[model samples]
Target: MAALEISKATRRIASTYPSLVLFQLARFFLVLATEMQAVAVGWQVYEITKRPLDLGLVGLAQFLPGIFLFLVSGHAADRYPRRTLLVLCYCGFTLCSGSLLFLTLRGLHSVYPIFAVTVLLGVVRSFNGPVSRAFLPQLVSGKDFQTAVAWYSIFIQSAVILGPSLGGLVYAAFRGPAAVYTLSFIAAALGAMSTVAIKAQSNPRLGEPMSWKTMLAGFHYIRSERLILGSISLDLFAVLLGGAVALLPVYAREILKTGPWGLGILRSAPAAGAATMAALIAHKPLGHRTGSTMLWCVAGFGAATIVFGLSRSLTISLIALLLVGATDMVSVIVRQLFIQVSTPDEMRGRVNAVDMIFVGASNELGQFESGLTAHWFGIVPAVVLGGLGTLAVTALWSWYFPELRKTEKLHSPAP
Candidate 1:
């Protein structure tokens, strides 16, 4: 009788979260497609130009659209049906991927076309981030939100684990970028279809008027919440400095002396570590010392980045990247929980947009920064200095945001 009851309870939990499950599935395919696209573009562009700075240019081009559309995207997410908006965005992604395929098929010589496609993709990303993140809270109750986030991270990490590996294998087998782009297009199309199956939910702010004050609400809220500001800014600076992804091509060819297959392994290493940690976190959600734990993990991430920078052996580099991913996973979960749980439902879209802006700056802009630094200094020095800089930011954040440092639990006291 007890076993029967427990089984039924498990079924109930699963059934009660159908929307969240569907959302995760959609995100999985979409993320996988994007990751594959990244590997293809990185490898192709590097092969064409044989320049490190061009690698950074790719990131910069994608990032520019997000900066300009940050506020408007958030507002649109709030004002529109999120599910519909997401479907549209996924369609846009398909177009971008298809465009890339077309470019490769034409036997393109210049890297400019690739950059143009990336910029279009970036526009899609700017809207997608805010809407997708804001849509999550509507699917589940406050009590189950943290658990939902853990599962969400698991799906994302799983996609990360598979995407680059598949991308590399596809590229190496076909000896061209066309196959990879085709896969990306199919993935994006599927993602859109999956979202179409989700039960439609209404936005709380659907009738709200668009104004400067409304759009900027996210900025004000973050500024008022010290913990949010600290957590988001900490991620921004740490990742901005410690990010080694932009330099992977150089490492693959010049430093690691490996081909496309090796590059895929190196790219997927961090995702493997992150996925493992995400699984654990889902099983047992984070409890005590949430803030301090995140801080320590980020510091560890910096240490791992340093080790990766200094290593010559491929094995050591992979291990370092694994550690980097594991630590960053912890930070990501904690920060996401803080952002989602603390904000009001009506403002989640805008707030998440603001968060995405910070994320874009850290990730894409960080790639640009890494490229510039590598251009000025060699790759090894650029990475080592960035890692050191990450450590310094971690220390400063710990001191400056004592409330965040002392935060004991993930849940907020706010109603």
Candidate 2:
């Protein structure tokens, strides 16, 4: 029955139009490798300094450039060939990874250089977000775009599940942490290569010229689009406050009393959960009441974070982490679908870039918040409070964004 259902779903998608399955697959590999590298960097930095501040610094290193350049990057995406932009971004990322590998292999690395490289990566990622997101419409027909977005989220989070496991294995096999960085370099290079397979026509410009007025127009559009702004904001705060991903190294080392292998499992659990849920969504969508569903998923995510923070047993912690991952995965899918369905074609790039900035900030800033909070009140307390904060934010959003609260079904994308 499951196989039959999957076949039907595939046929349905085929009857509709081709989305960027290949591009999404390549993106999965890129995300998987980068995440592993990030965790390894966290572990290595913490091991060297044994300070929570160092971890926060790592996040700051990645976020500052992205925060500043996001609007410009969005404009560029709308003004250039997305495929070409991606090639440049991935090449830059691959080079960055290779440089780090070289530094590690030569044993000439210090935190300052890592910090510099991370900032560069952040800048590249800013361009990457708008370029990749803007290219989606070219890949699929209007009707299938929402589904495509959901599936893409699945591919992304699924990598999250697998990357850490491989990172751990690679780290253990090499007898040094440096090998993990090399693997990331190889993975990023492969992702860049695969992007060559994508075929897209460039439209570059859509009427207005670049200026401060145009940039402000993008912000203006977002502010006017209540649902889009609200949904993105809700997700930003929920993930920002509740996210403890940055502190996984600390947990693996101190609280959980586990090694690299344990760290991999802890890090991968959320992705694993997300991957599973995404698979299910591909076959059977959540269908209606998406807004309420998203809220519930976030509520679950917050609750799980609290549990994971408080639990002493590794088994219990893993379970809580898995739940957190699973719940957040649902939120991701719903949010992506909502955004794609509602957005106008010309505005997609700018809005998505806006979304990316909020997303990038929430994640990097959340990491900084988690690390500093953990440093001050201890890790467990910090995590628990974050969870509570997420729930509180969700409640506030529910009251404030009535459009999100009352949302029912995804509209078919306009032709």
User: Per-residue lDDT for 312-383 in model 1, tens only?
Assistant: 999999999999999999999899888887887777889999998898778877887898999999999999
Which regions in candidate 1 have their CA more than 4 angstroms from the true location? 1-13, 42-56, 102-116, 200-203, 249-261, 371-381, 412-415
Give the worst 10-residue stretch by lDDT in candidate 1: 2-11
Give the C-alpha miss distance for residue 107 in model 1, angstroms. Answer: 6.6
TM-score of candidate 2 relative to the true fold: 0.87
**Candidate with best lDDT:** 1
Cα error of candidate 1 at position 382, Å: 3.7
Cα TM-score of candidate 1:
0.87
Tell me how candidate 1 scores on lDDT.
Answer: 0.87
